[model samples]
Target: MSLTSNKSSSVLSYLESVSTSDLISDPASIGLTIRELLRRFGGASETTSLTLQDLELAFGKSIALGFSLWQHMAALDRLSAIPDWLANNAPRVANLRNGSAICGLATTHLSSPVTIHGSPSPNGYVVSGTARWVSGFNFFDNLILGFETSDAYCFALIPFPQPIIPIGSSPDSIRCDFRLLDLTALQSTSTGELTLENFPVLNTQLLSRREKNARPAPRKSSLKIPELGVAKSVSKKINSALAAKQTHPLSTDFASALAQINSRITQLEAERCDDSLDLAGPCHLLIQDTLRLFALLSGSRSLAAGSEASRLTLEAMLFDVFLQSENSMRLKIEAAAR
Candidate 1:
């Protein structure tokens, strides 16, 4: 279901009928939007390039719509693009056995089934292993998990609403419990690990390759970093507000440092182009340093456990800042070294 197709005109109208006010707090509404997005844009050419500008616009608009309805104005500016839609559709996908958003960069390992043997079934191949760190898995009615095969990263979708394949849970994987993280940041988004012993994946569930193009498909960083960038900008604004009345040398220094790093970040962002790993390398590094600085600045108040500043530190530390920066940094380093 190509979202950019004429069929999307009606879908878009249906989506428009959904009051923007209802989308913010309503996980269901968010889920619907995600489904629409996938239906519209999911299976682009594997080697197609992404429109960074479009991504940024989609992200900002989604955030604005969600925040306006929920009155979470603080977070409104943190959205870089359509990640909210991507994450939102997880639950819905758990209901729809046919569709899955397997198009992205972080999913390169999906050359084969998650397990070595790839579960066998009398009818077709049944993949009975869990794919770790599957974001938006909760909403997916079926899952198209990627695995490292002998040849390529093969991806397959497994039907859902089935019994769980029990296994011991690990830190890096998704747990079957569906327990939301008690994370102060991204509390609204549900993420966890899965433990699959033999989660059945039928042969018909495999993701088919589309037309090859000049560029590779978008990756997780493509989905996450822009959002993180928005989040970082928001955090800076919040910190400025918090430090407005209270004067401290550390606060001033942090502000100055943040400004300086952000300036570099801005330059790098401007220079970033499609698949140009060299230009993106410095941007990723800048994000890492900026995150560290933000973390340090946010934790500055936590110098003492009992101090009034401790709470401030918690409020200041935006998780998106560190997580995306680290991921981006690794990519940059890898690209540079390569």
Candidate 2:
């Protein structure tokens, strides 16, 4: 659906107060529509035998669409120009859409404590503390917060507020900042620190419970597995479509390369599931295969600048960069080995 004539006005009207029902109810549809829209704007999807890729591509697509829509609004001179801070954060968000190959993997297993200290007597999680480099925080309605309680990490789903304190904006004692160096292309989605003094958290606002040193929930894991299928379908379709349009002799090579990568990745996945091979190694292999596909699809054209095709290639490049982090690779490896 098209936004209102006064897009900025409409967006504000749309988001002024979000009910949990409005925000969480249609996450799946919202994400899909976003993926299609971004695909129109030169984004591609890839899959690994991992769930975070699905979550990233899906949710990340919506956020990217929202941001793109915002840019359109700004271009129409409907919304005021984005502030410098917001502009600075756009690269991070865009990369998030491309990095669907590894979204949510970073924070899925942990929870943080938020101390809220404002308004009606502990009515909600009065978050005086800040979340650093929160991707799409401006649009996220609820955040799964974690805190240490009785020597355990307890997680709760809390509503996120606007006017967020972005990482690298400025340093503050009560603010949480994401570490930027850890992220590759998603410059904005870094994992930062949160600091709060006497922040109040209420019982009702809590989202989930993380028992100290407890393994991740199996239900969540199972749910994520299916989501990866969506990305796999999308990537396979795009690569095959690109393969079919080939007029050059080299096009077959590209097809062969993509097919080879996909074949190897699938074999690795099978081994991972059968407990015959370590997941850590396969996860690394997945990243490598994804990068290889990106290279094949973009070819020498990926190096050019100032053209529409170049922009598309750049998005994929940034995506691979974001996925290539050593720490992230390590986590996937560890999770797989487990």
Go through the candidates in order and give each one's C-alpha lDDT. 0.40, 0.38
lDDT of 1 by residue, 212-265 (tens): 233445543343234324334434554675477367557767777767776775
lDDT of 2 by residue, 148-260 (tens): 55434544434443233554544332343433234332223322344443345576644445566787543312221222222243356448657666775577776776677
Per-residue error for 155 in candidate 1, Å, reads: 0.8
Scanning candidate 2 in windows of ten residues, the lowest lDDT window is: 71-80
Which 10 consecutive residues of model 1 have the lowest summed lDDT? 68-77
Q: Show model 2 residue runs off by greater than 4 Å.
A: 1-107, 111-133, 161-195, 208-220, 223-252, 268-284, 287-294, 306-338
Model 1, residue 26: what's the lDDT?
A: 44
Evaluated at residue 241, the lDDT of candidate 1 is 51
